[model samples]
Target: MAEARETLEEPILTGNGGPTDLAAMEPDLLDVEPDQTVASGRRRRSFQFGWWLACGWLILVVGAALLAPILPLWEPGTPDYTNVAGGLSASHPLGGDAIGRDNLSRLIYGARASLLVGLSAVVLGAVIGGLLGIIAGYVGGKVERVLLTLTDATLAFPGLVLLIAAVAVFGASMTVIIVGLAVLSIPTFIRLARATTLVIVQREFVTAARAYGARPMRVMLREVVPNVVLPVAAYGFIMVGVFIVAEGSLSFLGLGIPPPTPSWGSMIAAGRTELLTHPQISLIPAAVMFVTVLSINYVGERTRKRFEVKDSNL
Candidate 1:
């Protein structure tokens, strides 16, 4: 008992033979928290500036698109022979297209197609890809190998070419476009989810849960999924703009929404012939698409960055 007491009472010594000062060591160990707090605060503040502008643009475009049917705007399909290739005017806010369609009205209506295809494709792709990725990552072995091979093959294919072929075979329709774009998006999400899950599955909490006799599915759903989802979702948000742009490209190439239906891509295609005579016809829709994409990208970038900061802090 005396020897045990002496051993317990002995001061812990450093390599230099000096008694270890636990109090001095505490500040170094705890210093990370305040620095991390400051960094997180800075990151939070960084989200304030310019974010509102991007949000405002999104709200404006979305609101305008949703309210288009009831809004006091001219008919999108109706032609005004008198205003053919006309510039901005009281009767036509943005101006008339080469076919005399009200540009502003068409623009508003076109948003429906663009946003629908963009958002829908992204969501579909994200959900399917995220699930597959999580399953493949957690299961590993043959399942992981097969899934990785499939994803690689998909990624290797030319997206635009695949889209064109699909359009030709399936007929150019919104549903086809959405599905094709979603297919293209799947590989990307799968890659992201798989990578994230691989890291998360190795975390201590996951091991603890498994040790507690939790089922694999339960551990995956409750532990792995919650951690893997945020980054993947953040990335998906950013990809929405990319898909929107892809939809526009399809429309521009005459493989998007059918004619007589207004879409930003179709509008630009229709107005391209009148570029020299009435640049506004093409430029206006093009500008709107540009601004919309820019705003989405800006907001998506901010969201991604915010998530990255959060992950770093964790």
Candidate 2:
């Protein structure tokens, strides 16, 4: 009796008499588990933190630039010549340098030169290196070997040493300093761009585009270049911080932008002699450089992480 009843029940369930509605058959499929919800919430919070950090640094840089004209800071060439008795007073918040110029004013003015060198070097390096990298990565064979060899040779030299040698030979000026930094940074961009291009060039989409008789230029610009831009942009941000610090160091060592122009590096150099007695002069500019570089590095790290997450999801 038990076996006969089991056979009859199985036939009813297997035939058209079974439940027909899709929603009724799998109700649990639509429900989200607690763990999934918690994980998603954590991801959202992390993304928010990254965005805020990046925005904060951007605001600081922009605010300093905009406030330069309106602030009651000293002119770049103007001499403070005030007595040491007025050290750390309200009139001179950051105190006076060895030459009696207000440290605060010099700090503000120094931002212009630092930012200019950093931006210009990145632009020049990215354009030159990016193009070469693209060509080498796509073409491969002998072309790839030659381009990679050249990049490796450039990378063999320490960046600061190259900058110092170039500046020593050419003399200390803004343009010369920028050129030196740019030249030193080109190899990094080349390597990054070439690697990114190589990965994307072998993708299915690229093969399909080529199969459809797309021109080489069109494939590169429309397909390969767009895919690699994010990683290159992240690298550029990190390079900006490096170039800024490099420019400052060059100026501090007397191999950067010439004096009387109120560069942060030169200010630190000038205040070094008085470090024991009036430490504020040197300490303040050093602090500014340190904070700016740290902030930029933080932002760059966050940016890289965000990009990595996106790539994983894709």
Best by lDDT: 1
**Best candidate according to TM-score:** 1
Which residue pairs collide in model 2, if any? none
Lowest summed lDDT over 10 consecutive residues: which window, candidate 2?
A: 29-38
Off by over 4 Å in 2: 1-54, 83-86
- The global Cα lDDT (0 to 1) of model 2 is 0.78
RMSD of each: 7.6, 8.3
Taken over the whole model, the C-alpha lDDT of each candidate is: 0.87, 0.78
Candidate 1 wrongly placed segments (more than 4 Å): 1-46
**Which tens-of-lDDT digit does each residue in 1-314 have in candidate 2?**
33433443443343475575454434333332323433377777876786687668667765776688887676756667783413777888777777677777778788877877888898888888887888889888999899899889989978788888888788888999888888888888889899999999989999999999999999999999998777887888888889888887887788888977777788788888888877877888888878777777788877787678657644
